[model samples]
Target: MKPFDFVQPTTTDAALAALAEHSPNVRILCGGTDYVVELKHGEQSPGVVVDISRLEDLKSIELTDAGLRIGAGVTHTEIMAHPLIAEHAPAMIEAAHTVGAVQTRNLGTLGGNLVTCVPSMDSGPVLLALDAQVTILGPKGSRQMDLSEFFVGVRKTALEPDELLLDVIIPTENLGKPAGFIKFGLRKGQALALVNAASAFRVEDGKFKDVRIALGAVAPVVMRASKAEAVLEGQAVSQDLIDEAAKIAVGEAKPIDDFRASKEYRNSLIEVGTRRTLQAALEAANG
Candidate 1:
């Protein structure tokens, strides 16, 4: 790894000032799951590494009147094990399990994963399905944005060079919203997703309400299959409707041909994925 100056700031104000001082030379260090690998490969040799990993202010998972508040630094392991998450937002736990192995899970932060903005990122689909939001801190103070807007492109985000992500929030209305996430990868463990999908909705009086379906690794970013969701909203709940919704979802994605999987195969996965998650989410709603 290339040598770099390291700074560990304990407060957000200090961190912001340090970032301004270091400017383009500074890079924030969270869980280090991706950044460390980049350093070892000589891909990024930043002049300064600000270890925000030690910022205790960023480590929390709580519930508020607005919804479930997850500190950006919360680890995947924590998300999988937290009682509040398991009971109120279990789809999130399902997504967390599909990330890297135990060692990486213990060290990787949700903020880091979202900030990386990889197309197949496991933490994305479920949140997108739930219409999550994010909080960011900067010299201008703080601002909140939808998770969709926070992601700009592959391995990129809407955060400015001097901004730091603070937390992720699932809106109060969506808490415990029935949702499901699935991924089709080369293997059960340590494999990047070839295609992944999630669906969320409520079953009210045998009809679908607020239906949402999201797909990953098939577009520039994790995106909602709005065309498919539109087909299901207000529709009578049934297996046949789900199947049709799945077909529509496949039409919404633009999967690519890659060594991991063919575009045709990914399209197939998108259909099956959409159908299965919808089924699972409906079951959750019924319970």
Candidate 2:
């Protein structure tokens, strides 16, 4: 790894100050599960590395008036074990479990996973389905945006050079919303997703309400399958309707032909994944 000036900030304010002082020449380091690998591979050469792993402010998981506030520094393992997460967003735990293995889960932060902005990231689909939002802190102060808006493209986000992701919030309305996540990978473990999907909705008077379907690994960035969602929204919940929506979801994605899988194969997975996740969500809503 290239040598760089390292500053371990004990507070979020200190971390933001370091980022502002260094500006575009600096990078933030939290769980380092992804950034450290980038450094070792010579993909990143920042003049200054501000380590925010020690900042207690970014390690909390609390329920605020706005919603469930999950600190950016919270690890996959922590998310899987947290009562609030399990109680409010259980599908997130399922997604967190699929991220690499125990070792990677131990060190990979939720913010790091999202900040990496990989189209196949395990964390993105579930969060998107639940309508999560991200908070960012910079020299100018803090700002919040929908998770869909936070993602810009493959390996890119809306975060600025001197900004730090603060936390992710699943709005109060989405808390405990019936949701399901499914990932199709080349292997059972430590494999990147070829197609991943999540579905969330509420059942009211035997009809689907506020339905959301999100797909990943089949586009430049994780995206909602809006047409598919439109198919089910406000409709009577039934297996036939879910099957129709899943088929529509396949048409909405733009999967690429890659050595790992063909575009055709990905399209098929998208359909199956959407169907299964929706079924799972339906079951949750029923109970």
The segments of candidate 1 whose C-alpha lies over 4 angstroms from its true place after superposition are none
Backbone clash pairs in model 1 (N, Cα, C under 3 Å; residues 3+ apart or in different chains), count: 0
Model 1 residue 96 distance off true place after TM-score fit, in angstroms: 0.6
Q: In lDDT terms, how accurate is model 2? A: 0.95
Q: Write candidate 2's Cα lDDT for 32-105 as tens digits.
A: 98999999988557999999999897899999999999999999999999999999999999999999999999
- lDDT, candidates in the order shown: 0.92, 0.95
Question: Which 10 consecutive residues of model 1 have the lowest summed lDDT?
Answer: 36-45
Which regions of candidate 2 fall more than 4 Å away from where they truly are? none
What's the CA error at residue 134 for candidate 2, in Å? 0.6
Q: What's the C-alpha lDDT at position 141 in model 1?
A: 92
